[model samples]
Target: MARGLGATVRRFPAGDLAALEAMLTEAPPGVSKMICMDGVNSMTGNTPNLVAFAALAREHGALLYVDDAHGFGVIGERSATEASPYGHRGNSIVAHAGETYDGIVLVGGFSKAYSSLLAFLAVPTWLKDHLKVAAAPYLFSGPSPIASLATVLSGFDVNAARGDAIRADLHAKTAKVLATTTALRLATPNTSGLPIIELPLANPDDIDGVGHFLFDAGIYVTLAAYPLVPRSEVGFRVQITAANGDDEIDELCTTLRALAERFELQRHAELPAQGRRIGSATPDAEVRLSA
Candidate 1:
């Protein structure tokens, strides 16, 4: 894609704000640069600082492009009248980011948060025409059929009426699991109250064994390796959805706790900082945040 567009692709360390700023300062001339990143990173399950990145991009006279595939329905704004079960207390990173600077662009996919296919883009009015012509995927792809559109519409309607309720349930399920398990870590920041959690092993290579162990026990999760995260740690991610039942949540938590004892899962340095952590529902489990 970069070759087709006559652009040079530069790779950087993940979430390294200092290095990013350095690169921005060193760039020559009036070259238009875009900071392309994930809203809630998929591999590590970390919620990127959209506001800070936006501010940095604005400072550098550049554009910010966020792929909010994991955030759309899960981490964004909650209802005003009620509260999320996990004590989430803010708007979606994008919603809270404000629209003062229209230079930011956001793309979100339906697979994770919406349980659908394809993706959507949010852009300012000024860029619509340019993007239509310049975006290769949009120009070359076939349109989704009416049936899929109908389903998306239906999904939207369903979300509109019951999204908050589902979000609450999702948080509750996550809280339940976290309360019981201590071996693995939660990748999402405690302040974010996100449902995506991760557990890292002392040895990076143990991830495959842990993944297979979970699979045999009737639970499925993703085992991520290098490039997704630093090679020093190999981790698996578990996503909590509103669709999950209490029994399922309980069983997974119980099994993970057992494995933590078996494998002696130890704490790592890459864990996100904690806000106010939710305690275990069960006694003796007492889940503690590393930092």
Candidate 2:
């Protein structure tokens, strides 16, 4: 793939449109095919600027493909295959249904939001012939296991019926947790149903200490350290679910606040900071007023 793309595989920092544009514009001359994005990109906690990136790729005469594994049922209405409200309008724009963005392809899976193990793809009609001829896996692989297929189909039906109620519960639980965490002065990013809370600790000792403390207190959150995140960004990762009621969330928050107070967690850092700009190398050119 790298050789096919002129021996270069360009990667852009997620959520940065300027960087994505620059990469697309500067890709080696002969490169024509480009895989623009993966499902829910881990780093940015978003789909990475897919809508804008898709337009840019087409302008540059390249093919764009997106894996909607992490976003399919978690984004649009009815959890339709679309970008997170934060990303692009996903499967909504395929050409088959008289939509714009004629040739884009989206790979969907039932694993994340639907909580199933089946996977599927959405491709344009023109590509069907090509896929039949060039796609080796589809041509050579045996039929899907009957029992597994039946179970998956059954799960899909259940998901379609109960999806709304499930999503509502998820949203309520997420909102409760987020509000509680914010009140407790824990830094967390705004997200949809994925209740991932990341707490950045200063060092490995702090990470270990916090993990042990939480475990002893009957709460379990993952401790992540260097290599996973830089040494400077080590912390704990907590995942919440709909099963967590308001009382449980409150308890978790209370426990976190107590721990923070005991450990002297930097609450000030948890609050959002105002943006500032330094004038030049030779100090400030003019006095800046604080808002």
TM-scores of all predicted structures: 0.83, 0.72
* Model 2: CA > 4 A from native: 1-7, 78-101, 135-143, 191-194, 218-220, 262-291
lDDT score at residue 49, model 1, on the 0-100 scale: 56
Give one clash count per candidate, in the order shown: 2, 1
The candidate 2 region of ten consecutive residues with least summed lDDT is 282-291
Query: Residues 1-291, candidate 1, lDDT per residue (tens digit)?
Result: 765687767876656678899999888879888888887666444556566778899999888888878877665542345556222332244763333446788887777767777677787777888989877878998997677677767878877787767777887787677655433553333334457776666677677678778898999887767667675556677877787788889888888876776664546445433334422221111123432
Q: lDDT: which candidate is best?
A: 1
lDDT of 2 by residue, 96-120 (tens): 1223554567777766555566777
The local distance difference test score of each candidate is 0.65, 0.55
Superposed by TM-score, candidate 2 places the C-alpha of residue 110 at a distance from the truth, in angstroms, of 2.5
* Regions of model 1 farther than 4 Å from truth: 78-82, 85-92, 96-101, 183-191, 225-231, 268-273, 276-291
